[model samples]
Structures are given as structure tokens and as C-alpha cells.
Target: MALPPNSETERGVYLRNVFYNTHPTEVFSTWPKLIVEDYAVVGRLINLYSFIEINLRRLVESWTDADLLPKGRIKDLPLGRVEELAQTVLLWPEANLFALKKMAELRSLRNLVAHFGMMRFPDDDAFLFIAKSEADYKKQTGEQSVEDVMLIAVLDGPALPRLVQELEGMAQWLATVTAQILKQKADAEADVSKS
Candidate 1:
């Protein structure tokens, strides 16, 4: 379900309350308040990204039962490799390929957010640079020139909250997938033991 329209306002109020609760004596200036709120959202995105990474790592661990590798090797694996392993090693059904595809998309966005700095051009605005959607590429097909290939898209103030909501939904979906895979692994092991 989508968040209520006032969710952003609600989040701002909650942050303000928490800040005041912690540093009761400090007065919040408007500029610093905005900075704090902005960073708080960024922190949230990074935290959710970490959650996705952990779940992806768990899926990778669950895929293999053998202890041939060193202890902590899986922990050292990067997100992209983990994702690739999950896609290749997991026994996903034809109907569930959508999850893997969505994962690939998420992986790209995660990389962009994790690695790139948020840039604010003085004449324009502050925005998160993301990949152009497939639909965007399609719209430019045949008319595309050497300079026409659009790789970056922008997300400014109004869209960040919605992006957070979408990421939360994705995290939930991935958790469900990981749980199902782990359960299947356990069931298979149990069946082998019973035989």
C-alpha cells in the first residue's frame, strides 16, 4: 500500500521530535534542520540497501551446503557477485524469474545510490542520478544519435519519499524469496536424512 500524502510531513515531525528529545537544549535552525532531514533520508536508503545485501548474502549461503570454501568467504563477496550467484545457483521457477529481474534492477539503483554523490548544480537543483528506464530508451529508438543515449535520470525532492517506499516494498519481497529458498533447503535436507 502507498503511504498517505502527509507521510513526508509526518517523517519530518518525527525527526524533529527525536532531535529535540536527544539535544533538548539546542535550537534547530531551518538550514540545519533541512540538512539533517535530508541526510536522515539518505541514511535510511543506505540502511535499506544494507538490508537487501544481507538478505542476498543469506540466499547465497543457503544455496550451497558444502563447506569447501573458507569461513567468511561468502561474507567477503560483493553484492553483484552475490546477486549473480543467486540467479545462477538457485532453482527458481519460470514464474519467479521476475524476482531475479527486479533484483538486477535494484542492484543497479543500489550501486548508483551507494557510490555516487548527490549533486546540486547551482542553476538547477539537487537530485539523485539514476539510470534511465527501458521505456526511456525505447522512446528514443531510431532517433538516437551518438549523444542521444541517455543513461542518467534524475530524482529530486518530491520523489525521494516514494523511492524509499518502493525500496521498502522490494526489501520485503526479497526477504520472502530468501525465506522460501531457505525453507526449501531445510526440507530437502530433512528428506535426505529420513531416507
Candidate 2:
């Protein structure tokens, strides 16, 4: 069911970020390479990215599951159902759409790199970049040599760090969303009892 206007999902974003201990810089510095150098850093990176990948897939699946409920069924939704969903997915559309979409794209990049040889890499393995979308490629500049991809080869690309930051932020959002959704279900049940 849809959330009420006053729910926590409506928390001011600044406040929400503060509440979540989620300054992007804080999360970024905690990232693999930014935090360290060498194989250990790479290992930490793989772990972080793997965490994000598995959970993101879980998130989409949970959303699809929650999406299956008929409208107005929050009251009818079994207790803890939303919690189950939120445990695996983000509850917000805006953040999930942008951040998770990019992360999934990053995962696809990793997949291609791992499965294919280093020769397939655009320039070198030194950085990772990607096309925003196939349509982005289709829209070329009038006569210039336009490329649809946004390359992260530039200094401080934020591609890897951004993914880590988003994963952490979304993880935080999942908790709040779970609580809010559960509360909504409980409130709905109370309303039904009163009527």
C-alpha cells in the first residue's frame, strides 16, 4: 500500500542523510582503494562491490514482490511483509532508480571485463568507464566525433567510490523504509479495527 504523507520516507533529505551517518565523503573514504593501496585494497573492493551486487539484485526482487500486492492491501498485508521486502530492497523510487541503476551497470562492466580479455578494455585496466545507455550512443552531436560513453579515465572519476557510497546509503535507506512500511501496515490494521 502507499505510504501516508507524514511517513519517514518523507523525511527531509538533509535530515535523512544526517540521521543515516551518510556523508558521501565519509562513505567514499571508507572505500577500498581510497582507504588503502595494493592487493588488499583490491580484495576489499571486490568484497564491497560483491556486497552491492548481490544485495542490489535482492533489492529489485523484493520490490517486484512488494509490487505484486494489490493496491490498498497494506492493511491486508501480513505483518512483517514490508520488513521482508525492505530487508532485501530499497523502498525509495528516486534513489533506487538512479543509484542502483548505475551500480548494476557497473556490475555489468565487471562481468564483461572478467569474462573477456584485457584487450576488450577500452584503454587499459587502469580505470573503468561505461556508456550511460544505448540510446545515449544513438544521440550523437551534429558533426563532432561524439561518444555516448562517460569515461571515468579522468582523475577522481568517482565511479568506484560513487558505487560504494550509494551502496552504503541505500543500505541505510532500507532500514528506515522497513520501519516505515511496517508502521504503515500496523497503522492500517488499527484503522481497520476501529472501523
Could you say which candidate leads in TM-score? Answer: 1
Residue-level lDDT for 17 in candidate 2: 38
lDDT tens digits by residue: candidate 2, 6-72:
2243323333333245444542344233223423333544565565544434433444545643345
Q: List the residue pairs that clash in candidate 1.
A: none
Task: Name the regions of candidate 2 deviating beyond 4 angstroms.
Answer: 1-36, 57-93, 112-167, 170-195
Residue-level lDDT of model 1, residues 21-132, one tens digit each, is 4332232222122346666767777788788888888877875553422356688786677877766674677645666656556555455555544432222234433233
What's the CA error at residue 79 for candidate 1, in Å? 1.8
- Local error of candidate 2 at 100, Å? 2.2
Candidate 1 overall Cα lDDT vs. reference? 0.57
Residues forming the 10-long window of minimal summed lDDT in candidate 2: 116-125
